[model samples]
Target: MSYPKDFLLNLYKTMVRIRNFEIMAEKLFLEGELPGFIHLYIGEEAIATGVIADLRKDDFITSTHRGHGHMIAKGANINRMMAELYGRTTGYCKGKGGSMHIADFSIGVLGANGVVGGGLPIAVGAGLGIKMKKTDQVVVAFFGDGASNTGAFHESLNFASIYKLPVIFVVENNKFASTATTKETTSIENISDRAVGYGIPGITIDGNDVITIYETAKEMIKRAREDGGPSLIEAKTYRIKGHFVGDPELYRDKKEVEEFWLNEPIRKFEKKLVEEKMLNETEKRKIWEDAQKEIEEAVTFAKESPVPNNEDALTDLFVNDSGYDY
Candidate 1:
C-alpha cells in the first residue's frame, strides 16, 4: 500500500487537528466554558483520521458518543462544532444536541448516538437505503469494543450479511468498555471473530498505525462500493482519557496509563514521518502550531456566538404541540 507523500502529510495534519481540537475541548470543559459530558479522542486519533481519509464526502458514516474526531475527519466545520459544545445558537443542533448528537446530512454524517450500540441499526438501514436506491455509496459504522456485545450489533450484522448490504463495521477495541475492562466482560479473544457468525470478512489490526488503518479501510470500502457486501474491522487501540471529563479512573493503575503514553499514536506517527524524511522538525512544529491556531479561532467563534432563544426551544423538538397534556 504505497501512499503518496502528500496523502501521508494530509493524514498527519488531520490527526494533529483532531488531537488539538480534543485537547482544547478538554480545557474548555474543565474551565466551565462548555456544558455537558465529553468523551475525548486524544489517544485514538489515528483510527478516525486514517479510516475517514479513504471515504468520499458523499459516503455515509455512523458515529459513536466519542465522535468529535470522526466529525472533524469527515470535514465538519470546527466553528459550528465548537459552538455546539458551547451551547450556542449557531451550532449543528442549534444548541440542543451538544457533544453527543452532531450531524451533517449534506456530508453524509447520520449523527452520533449517545446510547451504546445505538448507531448499528441506523447504519444498516442507511446501507439498505443506498442499495435500494442503487447508489455506489457505502456506509461505515463506528462503535467501541463494548458496543460489539449489544443486541443491536448482532441484529445489524446478521441483517447486513443476509441482505449483502454495503457497510463497514469498525470496532474500536480500546480494551475497556466504560470503566470495565473488556477482558472481564467479554469471552472472545478478538471482537472481529464475531463477524464469522455473519459470514463477513473480519480482520483485526493495530489501530495505532495510521498507515495500516488507511490500507485496510481502502480495501474494505472498495469492496463495499463494488457490491461485495459488508466487512468487520477491529482496530486495537486505547483511550488516553477517562470515559468522560471529571472521571476518577481508579479502575486502571497510574503506572499503566503512564506507560501507554510512551506509545501514543500521534507521537509514534510523527517519529515515523521524521525518520522517513517525509517531514522535518520545523514542518512538524508548523503543523502543531497551525492546529492550535485553528482551535483557538473555533473557541473564539463559540464564545462570541449567542445562546439559543428561550422560545426556540420547541422549534426542533419532536413534539411541537405545546398545548398537549403530558
Candidate 2:
C-alpha cells in the first residue's frame, strides 16, 4: 500500500485539478459562457483520479456524461476542456462537441458520451483491440450507479469477461443517478456485488478516500495488464451537486445536500493526508491555491480564444452529405 512520494503528490494534484475545474466550469456555465447541460464531477473526483492514475499513457479510457474529472485526471489539457465548454474553435472537438463529448484520442481518451452507460461498449471494443494487437494497454470504462441497469453495462461486461478482455469497469456509485436515489431504483446493497454473474472479481471501496481508491485501482489495473481478465470496481461515493447546471434539485432533501458538503470527498481526503503526516494544512492550502491559479488561466484562455468561423461549420464532420455539407 506504499506509494512513492511523486505518485502520491501527482494523485493529490489530479484530484485538486478536478475539483477546481468543476467549480470553475460551474461559474462559466452560470455566466452563459458555456452551452448544453453539464453534469459536475464534484464529489466523485477520487474515483476517476485514482483509477486513471495507475494507467499507462497509452492505455485507453471511455467516460460518462459527467466526465470532466475523468478527462482531467487522464491528462487532458485544462485549456482545451474550457475551450470545448466555450464551444470555441480551439476545443478538443473543434467547437462541435461540448461538455459531454470532449475527447483526446492521442492520450487514449476514447471519448465522453452524452448517453448513459454508452461508454461501456466503446471501452470493451478498445479492450478487444488491445487483445488483438497484443498490447499492454488496458481500457478503463467509467459510469454511474444508474448506468448499471442499462443493457449496455451488462452486455459489455459479459463480453469482456467471456473473452478475458483487458478492461476495468469502474462504477462511481454516487448514491443517486440523476434525481433518483440508487436505493429507490435497485435492491442490491453493493453494485460491485452484481459482478458475480459476470464471473469477474468485484470489490467495493470508500470512493471518498483517495488512498483507499488508489490501492484498489492499482490492484485491478495490474490484474488486467497481466491478462488476468476484466474486473468490476464499484466506488461508493456521493454527488455534491445537482444533476446538471441550473437544476434546483427539488428531489433531494436540503439537509442531505448540506451533510454531503460537510463530509465532502476532497475535504475528507485532506483530513486524512494531514492525519497521516503526508501533508500539512499549509501544504494543502498551497496545493489548492495553485489549482485555483491553473483554473483561472484556463478560463482566461477560453475567453480569449476565438470562436469557430461560420465557413468552418460544415467541416470536421464525420460524414459528408451533398447539400448539407457547408
RMSD of each: 1.6, 1.8
Error of 2 at 70 (Å): 0.4
**How accurate locally, in lDDT, is each candidate?**
0.92, 0.89
- Per-residue alpha-carbon lDDT of candidate 2 for residues 287-315, written as tens digits (9 for 90 to 100): 89999999999989988999988877766
Name the weakest run of 10 consecutive residues (lDDT summed) in model 1.
316-325
Give the Å error, residue 119, model 2. Answer: 0.4
Candidate 2, poorest ten consecutive residues by summed lDDT: 317-326
- Deviation in Å, model 1, residue 164 alpha carbon: 0.5
Report the C-alpha lDDT of model 1 over 160-202, residue by residue, as the tens digit. Answer: 9999999999999988899999999988989999999999999
